[model samples]
Target: MTDKDLRRAVLDELDFDPSLDAGDIGVAVSEGVVTLTGHVGSYAEKVEAERAVRRVRGVRAIAQEIAVRYADAKKVADDQIAARALAIIDWSVHLPKDAIQVTVSGGWITLTGAVPWRYQSRSAEAVVRQLSGVLGVTNRIAIEPRVPPGAVKDKILEAFRRSALFEADAIKVTVSGDRVILEGAVTARAERDAAERAAWSVPGVRAVEDRIVAMARADKMRCTAARIRDRSSIPETNARGTDPSGGRKDTKCSDRGACPVA
Candidate 1:
């Protein structure tokens, strides 16, 4: 599509999401890449705004230049924000209360600690990201599973079977240490994201490398493109067997069929 049409579509998509305030955000397109400019009230709004633009078709890349303008009523002391962040993490059942450390400075929340699973690390960050007066979050929580990491494929497959949203047969799982590589195809973009999330939820997973391709692009491109999934769960599959950034694929599978990470 032309740059003009792409620009209109991106703007419309920004407006379509109820969670984002796209009015003050400016959209610019060049060769299918979108650049977001303007100031947002909070960091969450800025993130959601970019997420909204990503759903639009033909968006090759994004340049986020939006500044965070904290509302006066939303401003809080660093100590107050840290206290609330701790409370939030403590209340989340998906996260281990004592396993996470929170630090706040200049409206940014930095998470540090060791968790047993990738999901827990992410869960901790997600909780802090929603707290009022937060401008940004830095998630540095490490995944250090205590249990030996074997049978990851079976565990992931079982997870897919138990979940109604995932198709177990359409995807493949490979484990290296606490890391995982997911390869296969899903019927939809949301399904691909769900598959990755499921992979992360399993214990012993320190990282998840999504390589699952969405069925939507199967017709436009070859079905066998070697693709790696992004952390955001955005669809970027192709036959090249490389990530969207054209980086080399991960190949650390062990003979035991999985890495022995403890």
Candidate 2:
């Protein structure tokens, strides 16, 4: 079958609402793989969108570029799930609470910030995957360890002693409970990435927020940095497009915990 026919077949198989805001769906075909792009409102719909495209007979692989937009309640639920997942990872000793940034749009979650491991990279994704409302995730977190605090400077010194990616002495680390904070500077992006990975490997860290400057400003970085509390998952079962929760709530806890009492 022709590629156009194949694309059509893919769209026909998956369950999608024609009335929904699917105008963001962008379709491109190369070889047998189909790349799907667009802003969806929830993770469930995003998955369903991919499933719809995947069912097409000639498609061999799918590249999902679809973003989840938190325009209402369901999207808000997915965002909370994303936040809780990151918080769980932050429970680690080496992971810093401020080091990671989590955002959920619709059901698609984007993770930015830094960590210190290849395992942590996968670990972060695994945590998010278990979340109830997640549809897909984009992980753009970097790994690189900084110098440890004076009291534990030896630990930082030991962490990157043999690494070519870090200057070792140029960065500093501070830890409180499981929250880790990295300070100081690095001359290159690779060093920054390596240092983040090392910090993530340390035990008891809950999160990390890197303030290190890159050697050069990098583009091609996806714009997934969103204010998690500012958006809500507006349910799809509507005609007037009015948010029942009166827009996004200003609380950190979502469906995973008690909704904050006003």
Best by TM-score: 1
On a 0 to 100 scale, what is the lDDT of residue 224 in model 1? Answer: 29
Residue-level lDDT of model 1, residues 1-262, one tens digit each, is 6789989988888888888888899999997678999988888888888778766766656899998888788799999999999998999998876988999999899999998778778778777888889989999998777656787767888899888875676677888888889876554556767788888877778788877655444432333232223223555546865446554333332222211110
The alpha-carbon deviation from the true structure for residue 191 of candidate 1, after best TM-score superposition, in angstroms, is 4.4
Candidate 1 local Cα displacement, residue 31, angstroms: 5.2
lDDT over C-alpha atoms for residue 15 of model 2: 32
For model 2, the stretches where C-alpha displacement exceeds 4 angstroms are: 1-134, 137-153, 216-262
User: Model 1 — which ten-residue stretch has the worst lDDT?
Assistant: 253-262
- lDDT for model 2, on a 0 to 1 scale? 0.58
